[model samples]
Target: MSDRKNILFIMCDQLRYDYLSCAGHKTLQTPNIDALAARGVRFSNTYVQSPICGPSRMSFYTGRYVSSHGATGNFVPLRVGEHNIGDHLKPLGMRPVLVGKTHMIADQEGMKRLGIDPTSEIGVHHAQAGFEPYERDDGIHPDLVLKPGVKYNEYLKERGYDGHKNPWHWAANATEGAEAPRSGFFNDVANQPARVTDEESETPYMTRRAMQFLAEDDGETPWLLHLSYIKPHWPYIAPAPYHDMYGPSDVQPVHRSEVECEDPNPLAKLYQERISARTFSNDERREATIPAYMGLIKQIDDQLGILFKFMEERGQLDNTMIVFTSDHGDYFGDHWMGDKDFFHNPAVKVPLIIADPDPAFDATRGTVNDRFVEAIDIVPTFIERAGGTVPEHIIDGRSLMPLLRGEDVAWRDYVISEYDYFMQPFSPKTGRVPLECRTYMIANSEWKYIHAPGYSPMLFDLTNDPDEFVDLGRDPKFEDARKTMHYALADWSLQYRQRETVSEERAGQMVGLEDKFGVLIGYWDENDIEPPAQMPDYASGLENG
Candidate 1:
């Protein structure tokens, strides 16, 4: 086996922080994921920069906040010049490859202006969020005009599935029934097994692709393989045996309260009124949906077992680093909400487990780290581990290598998550203008504060109500706490490092370069600054002229 380091970044869509057995999901036992956690450090309070998929993933890829990247919503293109994990890792001779979803939409306008063809090799990576994709599947094929799942659909057709229509919907996303199978898109039928077999499902298919990529690797170059899985997300359907793994008995009580629904802030009320939220709030819908959700997770765990065993057999595990995390969490009827787009823990906080092959990380193995970490930290961690310097000014997050090694470091006290809901239905319904349809959440271990431009701020005392049943946003009694959070948000916002073109060292070097060019200003005398030796006596030339 080669001594070069490799990183396998496994991301599961909509897998919540508490859904894994190691994370204390009582009924949903994930032995494969649990085994990974046993040999790794599980970050308990990890939060994403955004609760939504696209922005959260952009943050993870770029190591910058959503506002900084300016891709604050789904399908929003990341600006053309933005640096991502691929861009950063390439300089260190590490290749970053993608096998699944990134939720990345290319900045077509920016590319066009720069005269870059979309079909070019560089342009393809740019469009794919800086990844050389082995097989990129976002996994949502609804028979739409522009079908993004062309590769997966073709694979399904090649396997003797649907030939003419969208097999992703019928064979993979629909539930088996006595009559014609029902669409899994409906929560009512989500409990039924998918029409396809487990091996052919989306999870296993992606797993196979990842395995193929690893098997074909030349092994000379260090690589970071992003094995992203788009499951346990929605159209909540799981293939057989896993479909019946857990029933209603495994479903936990929904984390919501009448108090929240009765008197919610405008944003909270807007989310509660969404059709998906209302559907999830119903007992029958949740009962049907959660079982299939758990089943999908179990299927993912099994697939991970297969992938790990393959790596171990190939001796790849000896030098590879494995990271397991989710883009964001699902609300799942929490706080009277269904899908994620808010500040609640269920929607924002995600599970992060890192298993480094180096024996140095064994000290913190199987430990639960309560320190606040964010999605942005992953990029810097990878860069640091690959023997590259972390560009602190360009990347907003600190590397977690120290935390993994159980070293004492100055950790962050608060984490921020942002949401852009301009494209969501609630924005127009609530009469919110596009620019004002943003919300920023700042949270510590005890309190979480959400700031909406036109709406009253939402605050939750996590110390008292970890479930977040009550809102203290409009409460006058907690004025001091609210003020403190506001100040912290302001401090963080003011520190946005937008000047990426100039490094700190380069900026310092720039200080005297202008003076060397004789553009000196406000200098009382030439002696005030030690002129460079190359700089001749310009005064003598002036006098001679």
Candidate 2:
């Protein structure tokens, strides 16, 4: 085996923090994932920078907050010049490869302005979020018109599944129904089994592609493979055995309350009234959809089992640092919300497990860390593990290698998550301006505060009301807590490292360069300053007398 470490960074989409057995989900038995957790550290309070897909994944790719990266919503392009994981890792001679979803939309306008060809290697890397695309699939192909000739659809067609125009929808995202089959897009039939087999589904397909990449790898070169899976997300439908693995009896009790829906913060109320939220709020819909959601997760776990076994057989496990996490969590009707776009734990907190093959991490095996960590942290972690120094001025997150080594470090006390709802209907319906549609959530171990511009802030005392049944944003009793969180948010906003071009070392070196170059702005006489050796004729032109 090569001395250099190979990183296998696995990310699941819309997976809740507590959905795995190791994370305290009683019914969802994710033995493969739990086994990985048993051999690594599992972070209990990991949060994403954003609750939505594109922004959250962008943070993971760039190691910056949503506000800093400026990709705050789905389909929003990440700026062309933003440095991503591949950018940081490539300099260290580590190849960062992607197998599945990134939800990255290319910055075409920025590319045009820069005069870069879209088909060029540099342009392709920028479009794919800095990864060498092995097989890029965003996993949502509703129709050919919306996304014509998706690669997955073509793969399905080659495997003799071309009955429908978009086989991805019919085979993977639809279920048998009374009278006729219905698309899994409707929550009513989500519990039904999908038309395809488990092997042909999205999770297994992505896993196979990842295994193929590993199989073809030259062992001498170090690499980071981002095996991102799009599953347990909406269009909730599972294939065959996985579909019947769970039912209403296996579905966990929904974490919602009448009080949450009765009198909510204006922003929260808007989310509650969303079509997806209202559908999830129905008892029957929850019963129908959650089982399929769990089934999808179960399928992903099984796929991991296969992938891990394959890696072990190849002797790759001994040399690979395996990281398992999600872009963000799903709401699943938690706090009366369906899709993730809020400050609630279910929407933002995600499961993170890192199993480093290095013996340095053996002491912390199977440990549960409660320190607050964010999605942005993964970038620096990969960079450090690849034998590169972490550029703190460029990356917004700290490397977790210290924590992994069982070393005591001063970690951050709070985490921040942002949401920009301007692209959504919330801005138009509420009549709020585009900028006012943004919201920021700051949370410590005990309390969570949400600050929405032009609207009342929302607060939740996690110590007392862990389920977040009541909103304390308007209550006078917790005004001090709210104010403290606001200060924290403000401090974070002011301290953003947006100047990526200048390093702290470089800035410090620049302090005396002008003075050394014989440019003196304040001086009384020639005796007030020492002239440079290169300029012996230099004079201050002023007299001390």
Candidate 3:
């Protein structure tokens, strides 16, 4: 509302790059999201910093990789002192507000050590990934303990939708069946309507609240709204009309090869055994569940239309910058995998669309960028748009403004994505060694290299095997390519480890500034500083000498 630019960042959970019509899915159509691409820049090769939820979102929020932020898994709290987009934006007088999920875990130990009260204003921001939370709902992880009157649950009660018995769980996730009473049973239910009506569903609720925030905004200062939606992740069910929109016929053929599954990478085979992909191997299960996944995505597209219209009516489109992306991608049985935890494109590659309404970007609008971008780039992008200087040492990402303006600039030739499976309950059960629980992926347009400490590195040649059904890691013909990639990975790791060097140098420069400016702690003026305690004997001795 102030003349300053505003940012509306919309992120969906577990959304794949190829799902949207604009991204070229032969069957599924997302005209609303596609329309955004038609008027903006759609990046084809964008990747997230991690393949899982909490770490991925943390990377996006902080503009730092999982290793830098140290919130490597779900329910792992972000370190309290780490800076985020909110911290960077504050210097520019902008507030980054959250409309939905962040999946941020509070650093209880850090908070206690710092003597910061959990209920205080600053404490809440510190714990919630540095966001001044407008409304925080991590979107009902099936394992979360739900209580009464917590935002969404309260809204359900007020709306007269009693979720069978557990209103919140039943409405958002449960199906009407014998399995309805079982906690987390709906996660495997497919092609069925949720217990709540379409209007009462979680997607619609988040959309409506986001719109309300826009309408209630007084326009006093430029603001950023992280309108994050938690749907299309799991509990593969949608409300009536959306639930039945797609069926078995719409499910894309699984892009997997039997040979790869037969002799998979060590980590890959272990993950396949642990997740729903193992269960969905049955044709009937894949068909039933894939369509439900499509339905959930369709519902999201419809809600985006509503949000876009609201922005248009408010005459905010011309002055606002809209960015749409996802935290990660669902494997959907790709390579015999289900939930994201692998470096496959289906699990790590996500759609990234940026619509800058500023006139300077007119030439690049509607263009597709093949340049490599990662989730860490998001916060820096927003900071640059808000007219704030990005702290290079603190933020590991580069701004996309140069590309948005159609300027020719040197861009990174490769991107990095990693995942840590050590925290999973199944890790110990599988007899996985400590090093085996971690994996790192480095890739470029031509080759992708995956390194797991205890196993042989995996390599995929994108030009030949686009589906990544073959492993060239052990193949002699690709030895040169494999070696080159391994060196790149090593160089990247070393560079990342030095990110703190610049910050330390900057901190060192401030060592004498306090002395130059005169510390007022023990003095009111020059006369007050003339005491024996304040004056050093060396000062006069040096002059006499």
Clashes of each: 0, 0, 1
Alpha-carbon runs more than 4 Å astray in model 1: 176-181, 526-545
Q: Provide the global lDDT of candidate 2 against the true structure.
A: 0.88
lDDT of 3 by residue, 109-166 (tens): 9999999998898788788777777778876734356644468877777777564435
The positional error of residue 111 in candidate 1, measured at the CA in angstroms, is 0.6
Candidate 3 at residue 488, lDDT? Answer: 96
Considering summed lDDT, which 10 consecutive residues are worst modelled in model 1? 536-545
Give the root-mean-square deviation of each candidate in angstroms.
Answer: 2.6, 3.0, 5.9
Q: Which whole-number lDDT from 0 to 100 does residue 487 have in model 3?
A: 98
**What do the candidate models score in CA lDDT, each in turn?**
0.89, 0.88, 0.83
Model 2, 220: alpha-carbon shift in Å? 0.9
lDDT tens readout by residue for model 2, 1-545: 45978999999999999999999998899999999999999999899999989999999999998888999889889999899988999999999999999999899999999999988999998999999998888888657464765778888888887778888887778875665557888877776788888888899989999999999988889999999999888788888888878888888888988898677888889898888888878777788789888999999999999999999999899989999999888888788888888888899999999998789999999999999999999999999999999888889988999999999999999999999999877679878888778999999988889998888999899999999889999999889989998999999999958878888888887675655665566766677776431222346522221
Report lDDT (Cα) of residue 309, candidate 1: 99
**Best lDDT among the predictions, by candidate number:** 1
User: Residue 503 deviation, candidate 2, in Å?
Assistant: 1.1
